[model samples]
Target chain A: MADLALGKESSDFKKGLQAGISIGIGYFPIALTFGLLAKTSGLSIYETVLMSLIVFAGASQYISLSLIAYGTGIFEIILTTFIVNIRHFLMSTSLNEKCEEDQLISKLIYSFGITDETFSVVATKEGTASTGFLFGVISVSYTSWVVFSGVGHLIGANLPQTLQDSMAVALYAMFIGLLVPSMKNNVKVIVLAVFGAIFNSIFTIGHIMAQGWSIVTATLLSAILIESAEVIKAKYRGAGHEK
Target chain B: MRSEIVWMIVGMGLVTYIPRMLPFVLFKGKELPPFIQGVLKNVPYATLGALIFPAIIFIQKDDIWYGILGAAAAFIAAFLGANVIVVVLGSIAVLALYSYLL
Candidate 1:
């Protein structure tokens, strides 16, 4: 029985590795960009690799590099990275319900590997993923990011300026890809986004924590508005039915 | 000189780990309310929108026209129900070319 269980676990690991590889495939350009940026920011290869391994957040890492390159204060960089990543709190909160029971170790291990791409892919899985499967996905994504980042660092300044310029589209493309799937069922999302963008723009004029706060407010406000609308609509419908 | 940078990077890593790890620990055994869950469900999309929406039109300096162009691209593509990749690539292609030219 022990041997059989061990075999199952190994296969799960293999499955996870495959999933990770798939994630890595999508991560290619972003990780490469990360490498380029880190090198340009004067991060040594070892330092760049460590950041990829530790922070493991593509957008936040890029933002951090920009901050460093601009000579932004340490406190501000840390604060900004934290604020930008605050959304993960919600992602993990939702994921907690679906994770394996009594598997705190697995949750901790896998949570570190969470990314926008990973969360989108993994959250859609049907049931509680085995600890092994979780690691499989994380390992694949993590290794791909680190390896490609290094490749970028090594190829630093050698990459064509056009290619570097073009890669800026990757993040937007990835987000839109993720958005298209959901926009179909949710009109509230459209409303929220529009209002959020308007708010963000207005705040940008004033130079507030416009980037971070605009998003947080828009999301919260739109969500609240939609839910309230639903409740009111349901009440009116009930009244009409009674009449 | 670079070693100092390495220390900063290391410090960043340590700090980032806490946020990633804390949620897993605090929410481990319990279930949250449905309202909270609903709110949480929408955050990823909300976060993505916030991050991308502003930058779409206004590249760097106060550029209102760019914002309109971006919104138009997203609106048209989304209105036509274009696939995310197509919409993304099309918008970027259009904008990048437009921005470079203008």
Candidate 2:
């Protein structure tokens, strides 16, 4: 019985590793760009790698670097990171249903690995996601993210001065790349993004608040306002149909 | 400066970890309220928008066009349903070519 169980677990882990290969490949350029940007943002290679190792989330880390570049306050940076990653709360809650029952410690260990990509893969798997399989997928993706980050920083260090300066544009370009797709998919995303951009521009240009605080405030305001507008619109439509 | 960065990273790690972990630890089999879920869903898009603008224009202070052109390239790539990697690399390629011509 024990041997059979062990064999099953190993195979599940192997299957997970196989599933994660594409995610690992997908992380390469993104992580590489992160490392390169971290270098340009004045982070030492050690600091860059440490951020990737500890934080592990791509968009938030990229945002942090930009915040750091702005000389934003540390507390404010933390707050912004929280706001940016709040979506994980929903993802995690939803994923818990698909994951097999496991020990609290095991869940704790694997939950740390629940990135957007990893979560999607595990959640969509045909059956319950095993603890061993979760570990397999996370291990590959996490390793790729951290290792490529270091490599990108090393490459960035050797680039010509002009190229390094041009790299600053890459970060903003990356943000646009991320936002545009979601904006295309949902008009709500379009409204949220446009509102966010307008609010942030006002706060930043007007010097009404520090850059870090501006982002946090703008994000919260846009989300709350747009969501409220959506709720009110739904209510009005419902009333109209009744009449 | 070093210590500040360290503390910042530590704080960030804690905040990031808490959201990802709390649901698994505490929310077992529960769902968030609809309004809250809607707001959370909107946060990423809003944050992304805030992150991009005003900052993009200021990225290349001496050459604002550099920033604008790079953003245009990224927008085009992303609009065409390109993945994040292609969008980034495509913008970088465009900027590199622009710089070469300049």
Candidate 3:
């Protein structure tokens, strides 16, 4: 009995480690960019470290950096990040169901480390997600992000302009890589992407909206519109089937 | 460089903690509503779309054309069943070429 229990524990540990490995691959590049950008944004090494420790969300951190670069107010930056990350509220709503009662403390701890990659991993798990497993996921990811960010910040500060230019292209490439896999599955993703681009262009290029709020507005309005259309489509399909 | 920037970063760090910490405390032992659950199910599609659509049309520094070309190349590459890395590289290649030529 004891050995059986030990076997299961070891297996779950391996599972968590595998999750961490896959997550670390995706996160390392992006977090490296975040660190590099933070340093370039006039933040010191300690400040960049602390920001990664606290914010954890790569997209928001990058956007926040740009906002700061644009001289947006502190309050506005926070507000926009809050809106951008509002999806996490939904992510957490799904996550709460997966955690165990006794493991609430660990859940809270690991929740602090929740990035999109980690959340997607945890959300898809069946049965109780072991604390060991969650931490295993968090530990590897958190360590890699922090370490790479430090490396990037230190190295990035002294790099020549040509090198910075090439390193910067990695981000858009990364975004494309992140997005293309998912877009393959669903047509609606393509539609929303289109609307999001159009909305952003009209608002940003046309000078029709405040720059600080432009992307936020585009994301929110497009999400609502896209999701609403899907709901209506589903309802119509249901009604047609009923008749 | 200034002391105020350090203070500002610290302040932003502090403010971020509220949301990160709040969800754990507020939702302990609670089940989310069904509609909310449904909405959560679709969030990936929503957020991904929201992120991608803007990428194609708007390059920073007010350069929209190159960005749009990049996005279209990405979309076509994606539709052809290319991997994400391939799609991204294709877009970058196309955009870089366009920028150089035009």
- Top-scoring candidate (TM-score): 1
The DockQ ranking, best first, is 2, 1, 3
Docking class of 1: acceptable
lDDT per residue for candidate 1 within A58-169, as digits (tens), equals 8789999999999997778877877877666656665666666746776777888877666654554556666677778788888889898989898884445444444444
Proportion of true inter-chain contacts also present in candidate 2: 0.73
C-alpha lDDT (0 to 100) for residue B55 of candidate 1: 65
| Model 3 segments more than 4 A misplaced | A1-43, A57-87, A90-102, A115-141, A156-243, B1-10, B24-31, B56-102
Write down the worst ten-residue block by lDDT for model 1 chain A: A158-167
Summing lDDT over every window of 10 consecutive residues in candidate 3 chain A, give the lowest-scoring window.
A161-170
Best candidate, lDDT = 2
Lowest lDDT sum, 10 consecutive residues, model 2 chain A, at: A157-166
Lowest-lDDT window of 10 residues in candidate 2 chain B? B27-36
Q: Residues B1-102, candidate 2: write the lDDT tens digits.
A: 398898888888888888788978886552667787677666667767787888888766898898888888888888998865577667777877888888
**Candidate 3 docking class:** acceptable
TM-score per candidate: 0.73, 0.62, 0.64
lDDT of 2 by residue, A78-195 (tens): 9998877776665676667667887889888888787766765565466678888998989988999999999999987445646655665655665675567566658888998899
Q: Which parts of model 1 have CA positions greater than 4 angstroms off? A: A1-26, A66-76, A97-102, A123-137, A192-206, A235-243, B1-3, B58-102
DockQ of each: 0.35, 0.48, 0.32
